[model samples]
Target chain A: MADIVTTANLQEPDAFYADLVAAHDGLSKDESDAYNARLILLMANQIGDHVILKKLLQEAQRTSRKA
Target chain B: MTKLFEAPLYPYKRCADQGAGKPVRHPVIVIGAGPVGLAMAIDLAQADIPVVVLDDNEKVSTGSRAICFSKRTLEILDRLGCGDEMVRKGVVWNAGRVFFGDRQVYDFNLLPEEGHKRPAFINLQQYYCELYLVERIRALQVAGKPVELRGGNKVVGLERRDDHTALTVRTMEGDYDLEADWLIACDGAGSPARRMLGLEFQGRVFEDNFLIADVIMKADFPTERWFWFDPPFNRDQSALLHKQPDGVWRIDLQLGWHIDKEEEKKPENVIPRLKQMLGEGVDFDLEWVSVYSFQCCRMEKFRHGRVIFAGDSAHQVSPFGARGANSGFQDVDNLGWKLKLILSGKAPETLIESYDFERERAADENILQSTRSTDFITPKSEISRIFRDAVLDLSEHHAFARPMVNSGRLSVPATYDGSPLNGPDASGLPARTRPGSPPVDAPINGTWLLDAMGHDFMLLGLGIEVPPLTELLGLPVKGITLSGEEIGPDLRTRYLGEAGEAVYLIRPDQHVAARWRKLDWTEITGALSVALGREGEI
Candidate 1:
C-alpha cells in the first residue's frame, strides 16, 4: 500500500495558491464563490475514499478560524 | 440511416472435406461474427494462426447499435490493421455538451492533450465497423492465412474435453462436427455458446429503459455528443443526440420501464417524439428504433478451460458510458497476443489466466462507471433526484463541479495496476505511464508511437540508447531510441518527464510491464519472462 500523503505535503504551496487565486481573476464575487464550491466537489470526488476526505474536511474546518 | 453497407453472406464449406474426409481441426474456433468475433479471428489470423468464425446471421447489425468508439479502442483497432479506414469513415468528435433541462450545465473535451493520432471518440454505425472487419479478414485470406467466416452456420452443441473442445455445428446444407484446441465465445449478450455451457452471469440491472432511434436528416448539428438531463423536449427525462456517419442522427431518450416497447416503437409514437425534439416541419426518415434496458453483469469466470469468453459473452454493461463495445475491443486486444503466444508455445497456459484477471478487472471498472452514470442519469429516490439536480445546478456556474456530472465517463482502456505481470516502477519515475498503464500516443518522426511499437515486447529508451540488441536476443522484443526533441515535449513529459535516461518495457498489448531510470539488463530479462508467463513474477 502507498502512503497516505495529505495536501499538507504539497510542493510549491505558494504557486498553487497563486494559481487558485488566478483562476477567479476575471470572475465576479458570486462567480468566485461558485468556483470555490465546484473546486471542493471536484477535489472530493478525486479523493474518493470517504475516510481521507473526512479527515481533510475536518482539518480545514479546524484551521478555519486562523484564516 | 440508409443501409449504406450491407454484408454479403459467405457460403459455408463442409469441414469434413479439408483432410481426407476427416474433419479438419482448427487451432481456435470463434463463434459469432460480430465486431468481437470478427476482431478475434482477424487478430489470430494476422498472427499466422488459422481461425474459423461461425455466425448464424448473414448480415451486419441492422441498427446503429454500439455507436461510440473510444481512442484506446481505435488504437487497438489500428494494431489490428483496419483502424485508419474506420476513422476515415466515422464522425469524429472530442467535445461533449451536457444540459440540465433547458440550461447548459457543462461542456467537456476529452483530448485536451495534443499530438495524439486519434480523437477522443468516433460515432460510426456498428454495421460499417463489421463490414470493415470483414474486408480486413478477406485481405488476410488473400495473404494465405484465411479467417474462414461461415455464415448461416450455428453451433448447436459444444462439449469440453481434457485436451480440446468438440463443437457440433449446423449449416444450411448439413451438420458437421469439428475439434478445436480452444474456443472463443463472441456470441454476444444472448450468447448461445454461454447458454450451451450453462454459465450464469451475475450483476446489477438498472430498472429504467431507453428508446434509441436513428433518423436520416441533413441536420446542422455539430458532430459532438449532446446529452440532456430533463430535456425540454422530453420533460423530466434525459435525452442524448449524437451524429453518426452518412448524415444519420442517433437520439436516445430515457423511458419508464412500464412503457410498452412495441407501442412506443410505433411510427406514430416515434414521429411525435421526433416532431417535438427536431421540430414538426423538419424532413427526416426513421431508419431504426430500439427499446432496451441494459444490465451490468458478467460470467463469474471468463476462462472455462479450453472455452473462453470475449466481448458481450464475457460481460455486459449499461450503454451509458459507451463501454459495452469499446471494452469488448479491449478484450480482443488483451486476449489476441496472449492466445497467439500460448498457441506458438512461447508462453505457458497460465498466461491465459492473466486475461481472465486483467479483463475481469476491466469489466468491473466498466460496470462501476456505467452503474454510476446510470444512477446519476436516472435518480431512483427523491433524495437521489435532489442530489442530482444540485450537482447539475452547481455545474452551470462552477467549473469544479463539472467533473461530478456523470453522463457517461466515456470508455478508457483498463490498466492492470496490481497484476503479477507488472514490474516495479523506478522510485522517481512519473506515474502516468508506469507499470500496468497503457502508453499514451505520441508522434515519433511523423509515425505514431503505437504504430512504431507494433505488437511485440518493446524496449523504448527516451534520450538514451537502449542496451545492445544482441544482449536481448531470442526474446520477442524490439528496441528503439528517441530523443526528447524528436518527439514533441508532451511525449517527453508522458514518457521521460523527469528528464533522465529512462527505459520502459512495454507488453504486446501496449501496457507498460516495467520501467527504470537506467537500463538494467537483468531486470528487463526477468520482467520479459514474467510478461510471457514463464516463471518468476515481478
Candidate 2:
C-alpha cells in the first residue's frame, strides 16, 4: 500500500500549490485558502484509516499554529 | 400557463422566464444534456419528481469521446428504457489484447458472468448514448412528466439560498434567474458551475503531451489495443493504437518533452511518423490530429449547499484505462437513486451527502490508480524509468510479470468500505465472501436464487426476517430468500459466508449498504435512516 502511494504520489504539495497559484492568477486569498483546505481534505480521505488521519490532522494543526 | 415546447426550447426558456418572475420550482436541477446528466434526470423523473436539465450546447456532440460502456452502466441505462438502444448500436467487445512493440504480450477475455444479462463492455460513441437519452427524455416529456433541456443556454452565475438555489443563465437573446430546490453540476472538467461555486480542483498536471489522431486506416492491425514502449521510428517515445468502428483508428503519439507543438500540427510532419510505425506500403489517410494534456484532479467538495458535482467536475483522470468517463457514469448511477429517494421525501436530505462521500472516494481511488498507471507506462524520473524498463524486461520471461503489465488495478470495481452508509460485517468469514462485496447467488425455492431484475435495492435474508425493509422506510425493496440446497459454492463464498445467517441490503449501485446476521430492527432502521436520510413508519 505504501508502495502504491510512494510510486504515484503527486509532486510536493507546496510545489503543486505554487504552480496552481501561478496558472490561475487573479484568484483571491480566500479562494487560495479554500483550495488548500480542499487539497488537504482529499489527501486525508485517501489515507482511509481514521486514526492515522486524526493524528496527521492534529500534527498539521499544531504545526500551523506554531508557524 | 404555457406548456413546455410552446416556447422555443421550452423548459429552459420557461425556466428562464420563471427565474425572472417567481414560479414553482423543482427539488433538483441537473446541468448538462450529456448521458450522465440525462441518466440522473431520467431516474428522478421516473420516480415522479420534476427535474430541470440545462445544456449550453444546442445539439448533441457527434462521434465518440467514450466508446466503451461497461455492463454495470448498461444495467442502469436499461432501467431508464434506453438500454436496448445502447446494446443495439454498440459493438460488443469480449476480448482484448495488449501488445508490446508489435508482439502480443497478454490477452484478456471478458466473458459474461453467469446470470449477468450483458457482456463486460460495449463500444458505442458518447453521442449515440446522449441521443438515446434525449429521445427518452422527449418521450417522458410527451407523457406529461417533462425533463427540461435548456439548449443554447449557459449558467452564468450560481447563488445558494437558505432552502434553494438561484441560478443566473444566459440564453441566445436574454438572461434570467432560475430557482431550484437543489442543483447538480455534470459539467465537464472545465466546469464553470464548479468555478462559480468557488471549489478548488486539486491534482497534478503531467508535462508530457500526446498527439491524438483520428484517422481512416487500411492497415491490418487486429482488433486489439497496441502500446509500443519505444517504437523504432520515434525512439524513446510511446505510441498507442486502438481500433474503432468504421475503419477509424485512434492513435496517440508521445512527442517527447521538447518538441514544438506548432510543427507537429502540420500533416506533413505527422505522416512520416505514421508511415514509419506502420512500415512500408501501409495505406491510410490522416483525418484529424490534436494535442492533448492529461491532469489528475478532483474538486475539494462534491457538494455545497443544495448544489452537487458529478463526473469530470468531481475528478479528472488520464485516458489510459478509460476511467475518466466511465467513473463519471458511475457517479451518475450512485447519485441517481439516492437523489430520487430524497426528492420523493422518502429519505432525509442528509442521504444526498452520502452520495458525495461514496462517489468522491470512488473518484479518488480511480485517480490514484490511473496516475500510477501513467507513471508505469511513461515514467518521468531516471530511477522510476529504470524500474519500469526492468519490469518490462522481466515481463518476457516471468509469468507473474503478465499481471503487472495488465494493470488489473484499472479494471477492478471500487469497493466502498469506508462509506458512512456501510455497516459492520461481523461474520468472521473469508475475504472473498465478505459483506460490502458484490452479490452472490444462493439456493431458494427448489432453484438457485439470483438478484432481482432492474436497478433497485435488494435485501437478501436467511431464516431471520426483519420488519418489511422497504415498506418501513417508504422506499422500494426487493426481498429474496436465500435458503438450503441451491447455493452455489461461489455465491455462498461471496456473500452468505460473511454472516453465517444474516440480512444483506444492496444499494441500487450494487454496493452493500448494511448487513447483519441477527434481526435488530433498531440497528437496521438506524443504518437505513443514515443511508436513506429520513424515517418513515412501516
Candidate 3:
C-alpha cells in the first residue's frame, strides 16, 4: 500500500549526476559497471514500487539502443 | 573438534525398562534429549507429570551449533529454571554491525526498549544450552520429580494404539519396547518418528553451501554480530561473524551453489579464508569445521494422532534468523502447558487442537520471514542481488533505508493474532499486550515483572481490584492484584496504556488469552471456558 513517487522528485538532478560520475572517477570499466549497478539499486529503492520500476525499465529500454 | 564434544556427558546406562522384560507405559514419553526435549521434560516434571526422555546420543552437541539464544527463548528457559546459568555463561550482546564491501554500512542496537529481565540475545554454544537443560533435569530428578533421561535410547519403531502409542527403543544392550500415553517427538529435522509414520516434510531446499568455521582466539571483537556483503575476502557472497562464549568465534562464509564440500572443509582451504577475514597477523586455531546446505521445510501437521511432534521434528526454518531453535523452543513452550492441562483432566482433548492451530501459524510466519531473509542474503536473481547491494550502500547514509537492511531480522516470539483460543479484548489497552500476544516484561517491586508472573493462567489485575477466585471451571487461575497507585510506569504502559484498569487472562505459556476494561466474573468464566477450546460447547 505505499506508492512510488515519480515526476522530478530529486532537486538539481544534473548536479547529482555530476557528483555520481565523479564518485566513479579513476575506476576501471568493471568497477564503473558495478557502480552503475549500485546506482540502479539506489534509484530503484527510491522508486520503491515494483510496478513503477517495471514501467520505468520498459521506458528506458525503449529509448536505449539494442544490447 | 571443540573440547566440549570430547566427553560423553550422559554415557549409556541400562534403564529399569530394559530389565522389566516388557514395555513400560509412561505418562509421557519424549524423544530426543536436546534443548527442546529436555525443556519439555522439565516443564512436565515441574507440573508433577512424569516424563521420560530418550536420545540416541549420550553427549551434548558436538560444536557450537545454534549459538544465539533470543530473549524470548531465555524467558522460556527462566520458566524451566536454568535461564540464569545460561545468561551467566553466555556472551550477552545487543549490538550488531553490517558492512558493504570493506566499509561499515551501519550499526544497530537492539536495546529492547527497557525494563526487561533478559537482554536481547545471548551467544552461548548449543552444547552449553543442552548441558544446562540436562542439569536442570538432574536437579528435578533429585527432587523426586519423575523426570528420567535415558541416553542411547533411540526410537527405532513407532506404532499408534487406540489410547497410547508404542515405541521400540534401541539401546546398547538390546532393543526394548515402551508405551506412552502421550508421545512427543522432539528429534531433529530427520525425525525417525516422523519417518515411521511416513509423513512428508515439505518445503524448499536452498541452493548454496556455507562453511561454518568455529575458531578459538583471544580477540576483543566487542561481543556483537558482524555481517558483510561482498567483501574483498569473499567476492559476490555474504559472510557472518558472531562471537560465542569461551573465546570461540563462529564464521559463516557463503560458498555459492557449487563447491567440492570435502575439499572446501579442509583446513588448508578454510584457514586462508579466516586469515583474510581476521587480518593475516591474528592468531587463531580451528575449533571445528562444517559445510552444510540448509533447507526451509516442515511437516504438514505437528500432531499425528497420539504421537505429536515438537521442535525440529515439527517444523524447520533457515538458520540465519536464529529461528530454527528459537521457534523450536517456542513450540515446546506452546505445547508443555497444554499437555499438562489435558493430562490432569482440567481441559478437554480438543485443547490439543489449539496447539496445532497456534503453532502452525507461528511456523508459517517463521518460515516466511526466514525464506525472505535467505533470499535477501543470498539472492537467486541478478536484480534482487543488485537491490541487496543497493540497500547496503544506502544504509551507510540514509536512516530510512537502514531498517530495510535485513541481516536476519532477529528472532522474536510470534504474536498469534487470530488464534482460536483468544478471548475478549478490552478496547483501550495497548496492542502489544492484546489478546493472543505474549505479555511484555516490565519492572515490579525491585524485581522483574515476568518473574512475578509465574507459569499459570494468571489474572493480572492492573490498576484495579480483582476478586479472589481459585478455580475457574475446574481449572486453576492465579490472581495477582497491583493497585493503581503501587504499580510502576513500565507495567502501566505495557499492559494498561490509556486504559484506567485492565484484567488480563494470561495462558500458562504467558500469552494473553483475554482482557477487559473492568473485572467481571461472568465474562471471566466464559473466557476461561473458551480459552481451553470449549467455545461452542459452552
Q: Candidate 3's C-alpha lDDT?
A: 0.86
* Candidate 1, B1-538: lDDT as tens digits: 2454454545555554333356568889999899999999999999899899988877888789889988898898899889998899999777778888877777877665677898877899998898889889989999898578888888999888897888887887777788889999999988899989888887656556789999988556677788889887777788898999888999999886778998888998988888777666788889889997756788889999989999998999878889988999999988999999899887888989889889999999998898898888888876577667768887888775677788888888998988878876887777889899977998888888888888778899887787434334355578888864684776877887765668899988999999988878888888888788775544
lDDT of 3 by residue, B1-538 (tens): 4476668878889988888877899999999988889999999999999999999999998888788899999999999999999999999777889988888888988776778998888998899999999989999989999898988888999999999999999988889999999999999887888999789887655546789989888556567788998888889888999988888999989888778999999999899889988887788889898987766777888998778898888887767789978988899999988999999988888899988988888988888888788788777787677667767777888876787777677788989898889989888889999899976898877888788777788898887776555888877678878875667888888988887788899898999999999889899988888888888776
What are the per-residue Cα lDDT tens digits for candidate 2 across B99-121?
55556555666566664465566
After superposing candidate 2 on the true structure, give the runs of residues whose Cα lies further than 4 Å from its correct spot: A1-67, B1-24, B94-115, B205-208, B219-221, B233-237, B255-265, B285-288, B406-411, B428-456, B462-470, B482-490, B498-502, B518-523, B534-538
Per-candidate fnat, comma-separated = 0.12, 0.00, 0.29
**Tens-digit lDDT string for candidate 1 (A1-67):** 3334754877889999999989999999766665675566667777778788777777778879786
Give the Å error, residue B132, model 1: 0.7
Q: Per-candidate DockQ versus the true complex?
A: 0.11, 0.02, 0.27
**Model 3 Cα lDDT, one tens digit per residue, A18-52:** 99879988999766766787677667777777888
Better of 1 and 3 by TM-score: 3
Using TM-score as the measure, name the better of candidate 1 and candidate 2. 1
What is the C-alpha local distance difference test score of each model? 0.83, 0.68, 0.86
* Candidate with better DockQ, 2 vs 3: 3
Q: What TM-score quantifies how close candidate 2 is to the native fold?
A: 0.77
The regions of model 1 sitting more than 4 angstroms off are A1-52, A56-67, B5-22, B106-111, B205-208, B232-236, B467-473
DockQ of 3: 0.27
